[model samples]
Target: MNFVLKTILEEVRIRVFWILICFSFTWFTCYWFSEEFIFLLAKPFLTLPYLDSSFICTQLTEALSTYVTTSLISCFYFLFPFLSYQIWCFLMPSCYEEQRKKYNKLFYLSGFCFFLFFFVTFIWIVPNVWHFLYKLSTTSTNLLIIKLQPKIFDYIMLTVRILFISSICSQVPVLVICLLESKGVKTFIKNRRFFIVFSLFTAALFTPPDIWCQIVVCLPIYLIIELTIFYALIIQVYKRQLAL
Candidate 1:
């Protein structure tokens, strides 16, 4: 038994080491092109009307830090598919045949949801939020003029934070399904209202303080929750039929 456990641990360590090595290589490659990555990230900000197409760096190290951050984020974005495959490989050894098939489908669905929401955030949410904030900056009284001069480090960090939040939000359906399968659908049904409220609260918390932005984030989450519930119900009915 001890030998078996040791072998499993050794395998896990080897896989993890390889994953880290790949991640480091990707990170350095991204750092080499960090400027281009930053430009891509700042596209929405740059497209705003009546704004300077440059970001401010208050401190000497700020620019380098921002570049590093950008490179790290780009590395993760580029490596997500590879990372997902690694995860599947890591888990496949322990799962039963039936469970392995289910997990295979789940991983694919999860990857799709992850990239879908990622692009949605990049294409829609980020632009709208930046535009909204820029408009707020345009509001000036007679004596005071507010210009939207975003800091280099701050902008990249916020953008990355929003992307990370959206990525986590994208996993809700998979998480809900896992919970339903493990704890039984009746438990989820009983707490459905709370979950809905929590989802709305989470959307409000993560998004900018604009109602439109909140709605944009909330709508996908709501749709996915409902769809997950429907999927769970179908699975439940199918199981019942099989039993009969």
Candidate 2:
């Protein structure tokens, strides 16, 4: 048993060492091209009317720090699939056949959902949210000019936060399906109204204070819950027929 444990530990160490090396290489590559990542992030903000395409840095270290932070985040985003595969390889040895199959399906589904919402946030939600905030600045009267002079670090941080939130939100369907599988479809149907309200509340918490933003976030969650329920019900009916 001691020898077995030692072997497992050695394997884990080796896997971790390799993963770290890959991560370091990816981080360095991302850092080298950090400006491109920043530009992609700032594209929506740049497209807004009356706003200059430049961000200002107040502190001397702000720009450097922001570049490093952006590179780290971009590295993580780009390396997620490889990291997930490594994780699966580490865990697969211990899982039973059925559990392995479930984990495999979940890994792919979750990755797909995460990237889908990440792009959605980048292409649609971020632009709309920025546009809405920009509109607020347009309410300036002749006497008072309310121009938006965005700081470099703050803009990048806010965009990162929104993207992170959207990626997490993408797991709603996977979570709902897991719950349905555990609790059964009938219970979910019985508590469907509660889930709807909960999703709305969650959306409100994550999205900006705009109604449209909240709706945009909430609608997808609502659809996920309903679809999970529908899928679960079909599976249950199919199982019953097979049993008969």
Candidate 3:
């Protein structure tokens, strides 16, 4: 028992040390190319009429804060898979063989879906969202020149928030599968209206205050939920076939 405890402690310490190293590497790497990343994130706004392609920092330290925040997020993004793997390693020793197999697949799948959704949101959805917001900002009284220069902190935070929301939301399917039994999943699938309402509410909670953003984000979330149901059904079928 003492040996087991010692082993666990050693593993935890090693994983923590590696995590710190990876974070340091990622932080410096992101800082090195901060300008390019900032430009890429703000690229969508370039096409907008009343907005400059640059972000403004109202406070002297806001730029530093934004840069550090961006670097930290980038570090987290790189570290998530390693962290998840370490967590899985720590937990898997207690799991049965079948459970371990299922969990391992689910872990990788969750990671894949997370990054996939984040990239899609960051690359495709964000640009369109910015375009819509910029257009909406110019709706009434086009005579006045209203420049839309978002603060650096606000812009970076918004970008990070959207990415984080999308990544976590994408893991919904895997989490549902892992936490619930097949019967529970079937029941969840049957409640379409409830899920739709839940999705909208969740989107509203995560997205900007605008109704349009909520609606737009809600659609994909609902779709992912439905796909999760199908995924659950498929897993059930696969399991039954294996039993035979």
Candidate 4:
């Protein structure tokens, strides 16, 4: 009982320590990234012809809360991978060494992919969406002048939400690959044309009704499909060699 308690305490300590480490790293990264985040967010507004946006000061604390919340969210964005890694490590003892290697690589690679997707969205996709939406929205605004003076908190929260959701969803290819390995799916080469059509349709469904938006999203989906087919081929080759 004592030994088990000691092990539990040790594990708890490790988890706490790693979490704090992740928090600190995240804190510094947020400041470093804040300017870039702000810049990307502001780009969509730049294309607006009307230079009118004013913050409604509800209370003294509102502005402060907005800044604090945004900063903390930024921190959490950088920390998520570290936190995920820490959790992986904590739970790793029961896993086989082979699984450890595979999962560790997958987790780290996933983090890298997450950052890449966010970076790309911040640089291009979101700005295009925002700009397109804003322009599209202002078509009939001659009477009421329906401009967006979006609250800082709401704006930042929305930005974070989209990026986080997109990032999570971008792991679909990885999930598909894993499923293929586990016999849940077979090689899809024969259905390449169908997959392409289906992916484009998905792009159209998910994005606003715009050619550019659909293409921007669909391109990645198609690329993922191509990658999946290639990997499935490789797996088949390895299996054939084993059978021989």
Alpha carbon lDDT of residue 38, candidate 2? Answer: 94
Candidate 4 per-residue lDDT over residues 1-244, each given as its tens digit: 9998899789989888878987877766766666566655656556556666333545678666666666677788667766786788677987999999887777766777777887887777767666676666565746667666566656666566557546754775666566565653344554468767877887776666879867876887788767876777887889889999
Worst 10 residues of 1 by lDDT: 47-56
Pitting candidate 3 against candidate 4, the one with the higher TM-score is 3
Instruction: Please give, for residues 48-74, the per-residue lDDT of candidate 3 as tens digits.
Output: 555256667789998878777777777
| Candidate 2 per-residue lDDT over residues 1-244, each given as its tens digit | 9999999999889988988999999999999999999999999999877635568899999999999999999999988888888888989999999999998888889989998999889999999888987788665578877667789899999899889878867888889878877887878888889998988898888877989878887887788778877887888899999999
Task: Please give the TM-score that candidate 4 achieves against the real structure.
Answer: 0.66
Residue lDDT tens for model 1, 108-203? 889888989989999998998788878887756878887778897888888887898789789999999888888888898888897779778978
Best by lDDT: 2
Model 1 residue 181 lDDT score: 81
lDDT of each: 0.86, 0.87, 0.78, 0.69
- lDDT for residue 56 in candidate 4, whole number 0-100: 52
Per lDDT, what order, best first?
A: 2, 1, 3, 4
Inter-residue clash pairs, candidate 4: none
Candidate 3, residue 244: CA error in Å?
Answer: 7.9
Q: How many pairs collide in each candidate, listed in order?
A: 0, 0, 0, 0
Winner of 2 and 3 under lDDT: 2
C-alpha lDDT of residue 189 in model 3: 62
